[model samples]
Target: MAHRRPATGRVSTLSEAKASSRAARSRQLCRSRRKAVSCSGAAARQSCSRATWTWSDYALEEAGRLTHPLRYDAETDHFVPIAWDEAFERAGAALRSVADPNQVEFYTSGRASNEAAFLYQLFAREFGTNNFPDCSNMCHEATSVGLPKSIGVGKGTVTLEDFDETDAVFSFGHNPGTNHPRMLGTLREVSRRGKPIIAINPLRERGLERFQDPQAPVEMVTLGATPISSAYHLIKVGGDLALLKGMMKALFEADALDMAAGGAGLLDREFIHMHTSGIDALRADIDATDWDAICRVSGLSRDAIESIARGYWTAPRAIFCYGMGITQHRHGTETVQQMANLLLLRGNFGREGAGICPVRGHSNVQGDRTVGITEIPTEHFLERLDRAFGITSPRAHGHNAVEAIAAMRDGTAKAFIGLGGNLAVAISDPQTTFPAFRKLDLSVQIVTKLNRTCLLTARESLVLPCLGRTEIDVQASGRQAVTVEDSMSVVHASRGMLKPVSDTLRSEPAIVAGLARAAVPNSVVAWDELVADYDRIRDKIEEVFPDFYDFNERVRVKGGFRLRVGASQRQWDTPDGLAHFLVTELPLDVEREGHPYLLTTIRSHDQYNTTIYGLNDRYRGITGRRDVVFLNADDLRELGLEHGDRVDIVAGERELRGQTAVAHDIARGSIAAYYPEANGLIALDEHDHASGTPSYKSTPVRVRRAA
Candidate 1:
């Protein structure tokens, strides 16, 4: 069992701890500690985080304080403790040795503060390279790229308050109870109010079906659970495009029928005419699409899909929420466009209670991008950055995650410096990614705890201990609060209550400054001055991005302010200055003939990203283990396998052997397994071209009983 810290308000007794394990199975079993690890993607986000118990799932408790800076020795296969200055000097030497600055890859994690991320990008550009491969590259990259072309903004348009007035909610491909447990409370309220909540997923997650408020003593006494998801539809893996198209087709058919009855059409013609363009192209594409193919590809009957369309048609205000299931595919960008089209038909944007919501993983994933963490830097942003720092930034495009891995594999990339995160396990196709890391000339990981990526030893690798978000950060100016941006646009300030976990542990900004000072000898910026007081960093940020005008004043005014999004006001900021109803072709062929099953990777209840707290998937009826594949009962019979039988999963030349098979209620021809462990079964190159996001949600594989 993983360690469980006592809740902030008061520690739960042993009876409650035992109850927690059982509660994991029941709908009312959800728990989120009310304390703030707040990193409001800080106006700089300063809002309190509504994340689960202890901020992370036993991550802080498991990795004890006092982790030392260590160097990986290949001869003894051990990590020996080294002084901080030595580690930084060696890292600087390896970076300087690289003939071409572009040979080094600089990566950032979502957990980093806005200040940390800004300095990270600044350091890389100062070192003369634009190579940045961050965590968003593997997830939500499609949302950041695809949403902008259609709506003029990449972030979600709706706020938390939107759920309050939404007449209906449509969710796809994610399990919130495990991913964002905080949102389940909002969902519970929406469901309690009698609004319709429709769910479309391959596997029927227990969290989306029902939830009981453990916080409400009334429910605890009565053992009453609130029912969620008014209607649940099982869509096959790689079926998002088809399902979205089918819904649009049904709406068009409904519009024609309504118009013929001598009444107002189903389409919001006025809103579409005034705020959008390219409706004709989208209409034509849907008209030419075959209903039979949509049904076959989506695995949903026409009537069933039409029923969902009716739910959308009847509701005056509706919000569409989705996760990697829609964006981790070859057609991810197109799928996002199609979703924008669906909401446009009803004028869902800029309105309360309605719009597109893409739940981003990690606290600051969106914030990192907002502060300029990208391989392709816009001319305007680059100019502003250069002007703010009085330095020249490269305008050439550089490698993303996929490109970085490929460059390393081909011996073109030589060094790696990670701001945070377990990138080695997070990225797919470990076969190629792991070896690429091993061959690097140097690697420097800035982290609080040990992870798989820390072990991917290069010629000279260093693991530098950093302060966790839960600990206080005192710079030369004394105790300072860091801001963070949430999935929503709101930024909040985070103040850690705990004392420094380790005397030697440094904050991310300090570590970044250390790296910058050691790596860029000719650097003009005063890194020490900036690190003395974070206010100086904020002032620099204000100069670079105009959104943060009154840098220090606005952030301290209560809750952090929200960044302005043009789409929120129905103001299209696209090249044409209008929202678009772009067309996406239906994806009919997804699997190879020999690949009978489609396997999708998922995180367990005990897991948060690549950090494993324990081995248990409580909601999926899994506990104490992760080596299990979930297959439909009928698929199990077809393959002559039983619930406890061992099997081998193959994708191309890669194989995951001796996996226990579990008979589940998942959609036929679809399989589910825990991520990172099953990452070997996915190909590194299998990703979306436009956004470069790996196809982890849907992969065709062959499953056979093991000897």
Candidate 2:
């Protein structure tokens, strides 16, 4: 798995003269990309993983940073600066007061580094609980749960290098320009070479239409934007499962016709016979599926679905890329499983140009989980962790975000500790989530900036300032480097060039060690020793998770290293040592309940998660506004509403009132609103049953004209 990186995540074989220019530009693009589009701080750790470099909307994240520890004073209704010693003591007391370790909910964000996440989990498990709820659970949990069930691994099979060999790229439910602009360089190359880049999403995003490469000087001087999508098809929100089944059905029907005519079938019979299981069940389901039902649910005609199938069948090697749009639904797990099924039909596994790419948003959300930030730990993992730490860690299943909310609301959980996210606004049903958080005995936020979540006071609340990503961390071992794993499973070192925001600000690892030392004084985990030297922590991680063997040596290498992905070589690690074709029935419909429309949550160009950098959404052409709902122009007139009418976004008993409605190019029954704000109408309990991910992308709602 140890290898040098090229312009992409994989090696490229471009013409000699072009390679030099492309490589230089790629280096420049990734460097500036991080500086321009980063909220997750950039560290000083040396890395050559060009594809992993990310940056976006940086000013708001760095502005008004927290420099000192704060304690909430209820009488004054404000936070006053307190010394770190008192903050740690109060936090230790609060954690100690909880009768059971399970009564504490430990939360982690995607921005947390691998070293810090490892230490955080070790500290929590040492205290006798695995109550770890991470940000991945809110975003890509379906991919984590569903992909492994099919492909034997949860990570993407193809690196950016695969883009070189791919004949086509299929994009689903994602906006590359706003969310992950780094990918645009790869997509731009694909389009310029006359390869098809098919886009399927409910909203007509500007990113999918055309893109101007800031790195391409020729294109820049001409001011010409290259066409990105060969065809942009609008699929109804929450209708992916239905659309996927229909696509499969079209292929299956075509195969039957071809076989009857004494021609070879379209499906890869050899791959099916040699490498996969559960084909009969899948074939039966596709055959039995009614076309009428498919058309009704998918919101696409039979001809439209068949045309997409034609495009897929013609491409010899294609990469399927997706984002939260495919995962944030009630049936999100099944939808992800079907994506694999469609690819398996053409034998796309292990090919250079073809594989499923679950395009993750956060830089190290994947890394956090890799270093054991999961609430549900494998039995083997727990056994090794206990053996390494010399303590009996708890085996009971812990609370996720939903269960954590329920526990806190029912008074079963008493304490909360957040590593880096805005849990208060991040949690849905603010009417309920806000109060449940307030009732907690303790709440601690280890953050770099002051956010709304820090203001959600409990009986004891502390805001502890910590080091951000783009800052130096001079520890006992001198300037230290932390490691992070990108979506492609590339592990790289990251160190910040910027100095500390304040002399008082501590690193997250240091803060966690302080809390651990005070809370569990005699724990054998050796929190202090691990915090002082991150290399020792890496060694410990390598001992526990052998996937990271020789971690310290490999991480320091240029471009870092690639963790072994068995599925990349067609080495299936499933129970029977083969990939699977899982089958799940499509629901009768994505019912709107009492509402006549469906709402999907989105992020603007000027926004990242809960942070709003500015009011304008450049791509959508909205100025000084975040309270606009995007609806189809035809649907707007049908509902007796104009393009700029003020309406109440309602979901039964909940309402986000007086929101300005803006007509746009979305599907007929589908509407779009910015997320973490539209969350008011979404219930905390409403999420995928298996992965526990909120239905952020597909929520049924009604919009009524306001007085």
Number of clashing residue pairs, candidate 2: 14
- Candidates in order have lDDT scores of 0.83, 0.84
lDDT per residue as tens, model 2, 453-475: 67677899898989988899988
Candidate 1 residues 493-583, lDDT tens each? 7877798756788999999999898998889999999999998998898899999889778888798999888898999989999999888
TM, every model: 0.91, 0.91
Q: Candidate 1, which segments miss by more than 4 Å at Cα?
A: 1-66
